[model samples]
Target: MGVDIGLEKFLATSDGVLVKPPQFFKTLQGKLKSLQRRLSRKQKRSKNYEKQRLKVARLHHKIDNRRKDFHFKQAHALCDAGDLVFMEDLDYRVSAKGMFGKHLLDAAFGQFRTIVKYVCWKRGKFFAEVDARGTSQKCPECGGEVKKDLSVRIHDCPHCGYKTDRDVADGQNIRNRGIKLMSTVGQTGMETACADELPGVGLTLPRQVSQPRKGKTRKPKK
Candidate 1:
């Protein structure tokens, strides 16, 4: 299976399934903003201030946990079903341009990709990062040029009359590239790609990420 990572829907598979965006921060915006306003109004050194600060921090933590859980579920389900999953190797630094770019960066696609890669290795499944340069512009069905703005959400190939969801078309291109890469490399190539690309995931087992944090220490009752 091949996948496209996008902000609208978290991921769009080549097979037409879309993992919907969680919009974690968006959902919590009102509560967080209210807490922030209340936090700002408090006396800096007061106990009430600290209490409100903790409440705000706790809300942030909740958002993070929910986001992580959503990503993990998607990764696990994809790895379970796919033999070799393909995805674009995105550069957040480059992609994070313009006013709202910081928001895009916070999506943490890099971290999600890392987790998915590690899981694939553990399960003895294949995963490849394909070049994303023209995957979206070129038509996967007919190899026809169908350049489009980000606003376009559907791919209508004038040449081959192939119509598909835009992100799904990108996923198809990613899958095709991965297949071509595997064909060129053969079994040895696949092994080399797995070892070289992931670097230590296959050798060093992945650690659990949900360990509990210890509370503040306290003196004995005296």
Candidate 2:
């Protein structure tokens, strides 16, 4: 199923109201500052410049690897636990070009989804990706437009006083969209009655995880 990787938390209400711990953002800010400092000092194409560039690249690579590891673990766990998985038809080729482009690429949402779908396929589970149109900005309860700037993490509905965790609300909205899409095709989600009766969606086989060649181990085996 499609899931957004965000700081996991609970919702206080229906409207998405994000409440991030002070340290959470402070740590991110610190990392960004470090990256900026390193990036600013390096000359355009000198040897030292290349070295500094690699250093920054390694930092980003480490972050990306860690995030991917987590996503893989979570996706595997979900596949193990559920027989059906539904997610958004995310087109990262276009979406990864925004202000958060680099971060999004590093986060590897597309890769995570591919891994998840592959795992589902391997285990004979259902997998599907539906449209994600207006999933974030639209109110799930009333179908009203909830306009807010990117800086405004809190999704407060002045009309209904509804509030919730931003990511969680988005997940709920995504689930609704997936459900609607499925319904139009004469299908239902796991939450609906008889949803389990529907045929499992198709999935491609997951590629084998690569490893170093047989003699490549740094420590020779006894």
**Per-residue lDDT of model 2, residues 1-222, tens digit only:** 334443233111122333321222234546766876877887888888788777777766666566667666766776765566666676876868887665555556677788888888888887777676666686666767887655666667666777765565566676667667667766434446564466894433456855447765587789
Task: Please provide TM-scores, in order, for all candidate models, with all chains considered together.
Answer: 0.80, 0.54
By summed lDDT, which 10 consecutive residues of candidate 1 come out lowest? 203-212
For model 2, what is the alpha-carbon lDDT of residue 116? 82
lDDT of 2 at 124: 89
Model 1 residue 217 distance off true place after TM-score fit, in angstroms: 79
**On a 0 to 100 scale, what is the lDDT of residue 158 in model 1?**
90
CA lDDT, every model vs. true structure: 0.85, 0.62
With a 3 Å backbone cut-off (N, CA, C), the pairs that clash in candidate 2 are 2-87, 13-163, 15-162, 15-163, 15-164, 17-164
lDDT of 1 at 153: 95
- The sequence of per-residue lDDT tens digits that candidate 1 reaches over residues 45-87 is 8999999999999999998888778778888898877889998
Q: CA shift at 111, candidate 1, in angstroms?
A: 2.2
| Candidate 2 accuracy as lDDT | 0.62
CA RMSD per model (angstroms) = 17.4, 16.8
Specify the highest-TM-score model's number.
Answer: 1
